[model samples]
Target: MINSITQNALRALLYEVTTEPKPGLVDPGSPGPHSDMNIYTFIDSSLSLTQYFNDAVKIGQTFTGSDLTQMFFALRRKGLAAEKAMLAATHGVNTHKGAIFALGVFTCAESYCHTRHTELFTTIQAMCHGLVEHDLGHICSPQTAGEKEYAEYGYGGARAEAEQGYPIIEEIALPFLKDSTGTIQARLLDTLMKIATRAVDSNLIKRAGNIQVIDWLHEEAAAYLALGGYATDAGKQKLKQLNQECLEHNYSLGGCADLLIVTIFVGLERGYL
Candidate 1:
């Protein structure tokens, strides 16, 4: 769970990303059929990733009013090196914290746009299917030790899903925020670690391949919120209640991994992801 401060700040940014429109990236009007509470960002990296990275550096520098931008750029060099070694995508990658921000953006997009647009929904499902194929490989394939861990760690893991694609997604997601360095940082990192473990899986094809991916993502978010710290009393209570309901239905904790996605999005929407 992200510390209250980082979580709040991240939530604020996500809200801005969804509710406000900036040039050369996502147009708030284009995604279509939006609501006051529901917001969206274009998911394709080509549209907003570079601008978002630049804007984040600018915002960070402005917030701290130091030489952090150049410092951030410098740190990015090493991150680039690390990414290259891993053969990963580096488009939106600048820091690990960016992954949280990106997830927030994804949640917003899903909540606002894709869920409503039949065309986009079909496209997204295809993208999801592609993501499953790209990240998961053949669902029916044999399991290795890594695969076994993937099957057990979160929603997809219990059904014997693989984990190769999850790390790759994480690698692509890095590089948006500064490293965790304070109490808030630790909390954010902890939250990030928890979500990172489950987010991709919640969105992937289930091991049994039976349910909507978002259903699991929502459950994961509720579980995380139920964990107490960093949440409002109401948020905590709501999540706790949801967790109980989920348990009553016999869903495993791992099955609710999408909670990370939901938590980030809902938190961002409510000004807390």
Candidate 2:
């Protein structure tokens, strides 16, 4: 039973990483998707972190309950092992670094919720409460995209998002997942664009060297969504066009990609998607 949650978590990870036509993300069938990494890198990263996900599940299942602080710490230690395995697998490429963080929390949260048979969002909130304040608030110098975005723009990036129990995922992705009627791939594709249109997406901003890039992404994604998203025939063409647009400019919606994974993980845990 404990390992089953880990396996489900792996499915969420695999589903996120392998889905194609995802604008600017590494996916199967995209021969030369992004310059820095490829589909193989993402597959390697996901496969390498299996044990870490399982370990977090075991730790969460064994936890004594109401100890979110300690659960988070244990997950972090487990996260480090995942990161090491990722680096080894990808040969130093940061394929799923954001995923490692988000999925680590999700795994721990899932473990706790499973052990207690609690609601997914409630347990996730408890697991990640004070994340930004306790972990990222004291950074003297912001270096990474998340930290720099927090320091400069006051956008907490993933930490702030998690601390708030992922408002964006709840408000945007989950609703889309529940209401949208289509195959899982079609629905997830639409939801991914929906998130792309709204998320702060620090990864896109950092890589493009400015915030305007994400703004453009928002506009482009909104326009594609306006055409009916990935559910319609025209929307499919629009999505492909958007993919070409991003690929031409070397754009990657990695931040939104992470949230997409979060959305999928939550949906899976809650049996919504």
Candidate 3:
């Protein structure tokens, strides 16, 4: 079970980076807006986190404590180590930092649910309860990008998403991906845009240096989906244009990308991918 769960987590990371034409993201054909890293960097980073995924599952499978939050803290410590490994692999490039958190929580939650015969999302919610308050509620001086975003815009970023059990993945991306048709690339691209429509995307905001860009991002993604989303020529053109614009503005929808990774993990676990 641990091997399978870790494999799915690795697959999810690889799948998200390989999905093409993703606006402002690193892909095989192009590095998109990022000037620091490329597809190889992401691959190296993904490969480096295998042990972290294994540890997450082991923690979940063996946790017998009543306080699931403690389990979450244990996983977070491993996640910090995973982030260091990812940085080492990428030579200081911050590829997969967000993924290290979101995917770690889901991988841990999935294993816990499998062992206890409980629901996955609710287990995640229980594990992540009070995450936002504990991490963001007492912020006096902003340090990380997430803390800064919370300080300035009240956006909770990944921590808030986990606390809510990843509503975007549960209610949107997974459902959209399950029902999506066409090539795997097309399905994932469409699902990514759908996620972009709803995700706050702190990375995008940070790159644009304004929270208003999220509205523009949402509008563009919604318009792309309205054009039939990667299956139609018009939708493809729109995505290309969106990709160009993101490159021009140097905006990266990394938050949405992390959501897509977690969605893919769950989809794979549920046998939909």
* Structural similarity to truth (TM-score) of each candidate: 0.26, 0.92, 0.98
lDDT of 3 by residue, 1-273 (tens): 349999999999999999998998999999998889999999999999999999999999999999999999999999999999999999999999899999999999999999999999999999999999999999899998889999999989889999998888889899999999999999999999999999999999999899999999999999999999999999999999999999888889888999999999999999888
Clashing pairs in 2: none
> lDDT of each structure?
0.34, 0.81, 0.93
lDDT of 2 by residue, 27-63 (tens): 7767334677787788778888889888888887888
Q: Which digits, one per residue and each the tens of the lDDT, describe model 1 over residues 1-273?
A: 333333433443443334312111112443212111112322222223333333433333233223323433343443344334222332433222333333322332333232344231222232223333343455455365334434454333412221122332233212211222334323342344345334444323333244464455445554554554233465445444544543344333222222333334334434442
Which candidate should be chosen as best, given TM-score against the real structure?
Answer: 3
Candidate 2: which stretches are off by over 4 Å?
Answer: 31-33
Of candidates 2 and 1, the better by TM-score = 2
Lowest summed lDDT over 10 consecutive residues: which window, candidate 1? 30-39
Per the 3 Å backbone cut-off, how many clashing residue pairs does candidate 1 have?
A: 13
Clash counts for all predictions: 13, 0, 0
Which prediction has more favorable TM-score, 1 or 3? 3
State in Å the error of residue 233, model 3. 0.7
Worst 10 residues of 2 by lDDT: 28-37
